[model samples]
Target: MDRSFEIQCPPFDLELSRWDTVFPHWGRSFPPSHARRIHCFSLGRNADKESLVGHLHVAFHHTVQRVPFLAGSIVPSLEGGNHQRKVVPQGVARLDIRDLSHKLSFDRLAEEGFSQHLLAEVLCSTEDNTPHVCLFEANFIDRGLLLVVSISHIVADGRGVTEMIKIFAQNLCKAQAGLIGYPLETTQEVYRSDRRRIVTGNGVPGPVEAHPALTSAAAGTHSRLADVGTCCRTYRIGADALVALKKAASSAANNSWISTNDAISAFIWRSIMVARHRAGFLDAGNEVHVAQPVDCRALLGLEEPYFGNAIYMTQGSLPFADLAGAATGLSAAARIIRAQIRTATAERFRDVVGCSERAEQEPHTRMKIADDVLAGGIILTSHFKFGLHQVDFGPAFEGRHVKALRFPVRGTMVGAVIVLPRLPDGSCEFMITEQGRTVECLVDDVFCRFTAETKTAKSVLPPSPTSPSRNGQAEFVFPESTSVKESTALNMTTLQAPHTGTIKIIEMNRPKAKNAISLQMLRQLHDEVERIHGENTTGGTRVLILASALDDVFCAGADLKQRSVMSDAQVEEFLALLRETTCKLAQLPIPTIAAVAGAALGGGLELALCCHLRVFSSTAVVGLPETKLGIIPGAGGTYRLPRIVGISHARDVILTGRRVEAQEAFAMGLCNRLVSHDSSGTERGRALQAAIELATDICGGAPLAVRAATGALSLASPAGEEAAYASLLHTTDRLEGLSSFGEKRAAVFVGE
Candidate 1:
């Protein structure tokens, strides 16, 4: 009853253009998370099978000639260097044909639609690891033919696929018209790899180093990995309803225009919230977060037809209670979503791209959201602007155009909504994936009425005023505690041994240049840690917290301005000393934490990486940007970062010098915790307080046990767990822990 056959054509070679290399980084960082989009087109009444097959073969050959990359295979860079791997278009593109004419009528195929299992089999039939395009056709007896094209995400994004399909359709039309020669003007010009288009300044410093495969966290986060019990339903929203929703949102806010996407996103978000509340899945106090991916080709000044992964995923958060109440809730939610969309300016897009580039350089850094945010978040992707309706196959075809395009459900998350292009009747289709109860509640009369009805009120609210500034320039305000005082006890560095020396706080004191580490400062830090280790022989100091006294900067890395005066030999000596000091800090018997408030770059980040854990303020950014200066991260960064995050992520960070913000750092496991700044206090103050509290909590644990655990976990990289287990077995703290557990009280033990 099940029938499908794949024909692998002869292989062809294609030399990659400059643009091909630019895409390898995207493929390396983000593997295919979503299944290949299968668009079903009705080919009217079927003609003779032999004639149809012959026509299709000639059209496909012409398509390959016009778009050579479709038959190419993605080749990754093998040697470690700055040059990205090339896409060698030297492979066969498979054509799959499935005949359901005997088992089912054409009407039946149209009525029942393609099952998930059948579509998945056709798209995922390829067993190779490389990326190549494929085409599938399902034939029915009475109605027509169903055509499905599968494109790898690694090769192209949605926009790219759309363009390729358009070209193929055009080629088919030309052949059907009996034209001997197709116009060259109809062919698309392949763009070159122009770093100037994506990034500013000197562009990519050198050839890109090949990164490893993506980690599960980074690659699987955006995928549709939902449960088996889940169902996919398509809801139609008429143009009139969309207009009414937008009008309601616009009227609710003073002179604020709401886009159609914003209005629909808000409506869907509110519906989900209501459904969750009705099903007892809503948390009253927590905020509901929505993430949307925005294509940034226009923002980056690239042409609309540019082919690549040029999208940034951004998020917005709103109070759950706000979206669960009256009709006004929908309007308010729309405003919030609109504001989030508006914030994605050119500068923000550049920042995200820069971060991606840096992440690509590091062999181990992964880009992910915080655990709390990912659990209940809603991800909405709108493809209405893709112009899917305009894809014309040929005059011989039945419908001659795509009726609808559907994306497969690949995630097990709670909310995922995809908005397709408008139908011929001006009705938009929304493919929603959620729990059965949530879907049932969303389709009920109550929520449906809210979306269908229009608000009659014309009352316009007043626009919020902007912050006042003198002469169109904002005034600078300094933190209350900007004054720096000296401590003579530790002359080399500023050491605060509060809580009877149980928690040692070492603050980098250079404020003039944002705490840049000079050679003398490095030496002083080394000696100070050595002294602290020697003094804590009796387990008096259980935790060490590294911080910066400056209000905005934790540490800016090596003192480049100072290093300009130093001889070449002095620079080498300083680097050696910096490496040794960081190693000593990492090997410390007690637990260590880095409390970062602002920028931590190069050696600054290297020092933080040496610590057992890191706590970052909302404003903190960490990266190893030595590659920008035509150098590599020499001080243990190349080695330690991979062990921390993973080799793939490490390559992204190291090679591209991407700056990692606090939230992303926490998600990637680069920072153990993230601390948001308080409105009433400076960021540095909040971060320091958090660090002190964390150190205090660590101090409460049995000091000997903490030391033993730290030593064992540190041995995981070099000697593996055997050394760690041997070390743990020799420690008497294990017996103490067991005895305390039996005694049903906190463990209090001596160094013995």
Candidate 2:
């Protein structure tokens, strides 16, 4: 009955396994203590609370007798110092029950998308006054019951916990069957708790190769890992999608055999990498490493029921381009993952154990490992094989009424992807934890595809300005419009002229902020640009005129107030997004015109540089003033400005951080047109009118011809020129043009 016991030596002290020793040294990286695994089980409408709690306690007591370490506390051994720790057996682990039938319900949680706040209310408290006690807390709600278990990772891996749960459930079932105190028979001979057997190697260590987890921290791959504000999102992949993915992967691998794990893991990895690239967290030139925790019980000759941390980190690497590529990326990534898995043999695990033990002895190397393991490129942990779905409490209640399981995490490392247990139908749930913005971007990336299938899933995406079509493969669809002021959406508005086929105008609004580019504004702009890029193949738009609604200023550049509050990671992400948006704008298939009526400084000037033509009013001033703020123009200004004007002019504009007047800018070939305030309209109005006129003129030309001409110029090669000419040879527009010339009449040509 005594729950508290004095710490003793000898029999009470259990030696720590090598796997446990390498798990971040209890309380450094793992808050409060070494890694804690939290699992929640939703028992639907099971109202036998009194009986269940009694049974759970009885079952836990009996299970603890078999696995005594479950009720123990891990501490540094008195003789071995902190480097060699051991678990001291305490007493019984407690089970607490709470009735919250009045405040919460399963339906309410589902309605609220199972938010973290609500989850925290149900899950066992992260704060444990008795840190030594690994306990279970059951929260009872209306029409449901929630059971949460928290266990230290040092004492057990997922399989170990699963085994414990299995025994506990089996005993509960036995109690329900009138065998109240009878302990379920376990394979005691096969069960081994000795840490030495986990790593069968000589004490003498060999040379350790640099691990990705250790090296990535020093290389600064995830420098912002700690600074980033993190959040978790859940998604479920249906059985059909898994089947399709496996088939597609196999075909892509030239009919080579592939496993379901490889296919799904590869698919998720590729999707995330692509999302990261689109979110500006990574670039195509960078290479990303994925570390998967492989269960080493089988490889190390340990039985399935063996307790302790018998896990090893297996790593696979891929270039961003390969993972994010449109073709064969999924299969390539899958092959890489499979290769890594195949290489995780017994010999390799022994080598890893040797390397790990040797590295941990060195303070510098140990710290590096602890820091980098969480901050590395990615860590994929799959719990599908843990038999979570097979957990049965008893036949007395709805034994199969396990609705959902949640891990109420207080914190997360960078790029952590946890594959949760599979549903009865083979569908798998995923928990992705990352920076707030990265999660937002990931939501957009994943939801933008197969949205129809995930209609029941919670959506964390902000309301899109334009609804993308979910027919088959999802695509952004821009609604056709006539000449009218487009309704204000997120940041900007779109307007299309009646006479100019598809010549659209993007008006930057936010007069109060002086059209400053905030993160939201940048995301919206990027989304619009991407939509236009997709529309290009269908000849949806002919010309794009970038203008501002504010009369006195085109844009004041990045919102300094917003930037001041942003973290370094956020700033970097924003800058990357701005840079990518500008690059996309510059590479538009159609002609692009920027109407700068007033001050266009720093990123504002960079935005103008992306346009093919810059039309500035006489009252306008342009310059890259980023140098004044102790920063360079990050949004392609430093590179594009020199490409636009000569290097001398670009240097004069950038180095001094001095604004150039419209006349000076035009003289230096910075602006294509400098319009004076004529009788037409005000300074800003006149600038927009001039840009519109230019766009109208461009729209008059054959769309195909103009597109071909721009493509040829962009390519700037003999092959490009020939291809451009050949592309027009068979077009209906060419025939129309010839007929118009011969007949001396204007040709009414379609885009084709």
lDDT tens string, model 1, 126-198? 3324355555454434445555666655455667777777877787777777762323222344523443354
lDDT of 2 by residue, 647-747 (tens): 99988988999989999999999999889766767898889889989987787778888889988988889999999999999998899999999999987
Which residue pairs show backbone clashes in model 2? none
Assess each prediction's global lDDT (C-alpha) against the native.
Answer: 0.61, 0.67
Number of backbone collisions per candidate, in order? 42, 0
Candidate 2 stretches greater than 4 Å from native:
1-13, 24-46, 79-81, 111-117, 122-124, 128-130, 181-192, 203-205, 210-224, 251-255, 366-376, 446-448, 451-542, 545-698, 701-744, 747-752
lDDT (Cα, 0-100) at 592 in candidate 1: 93
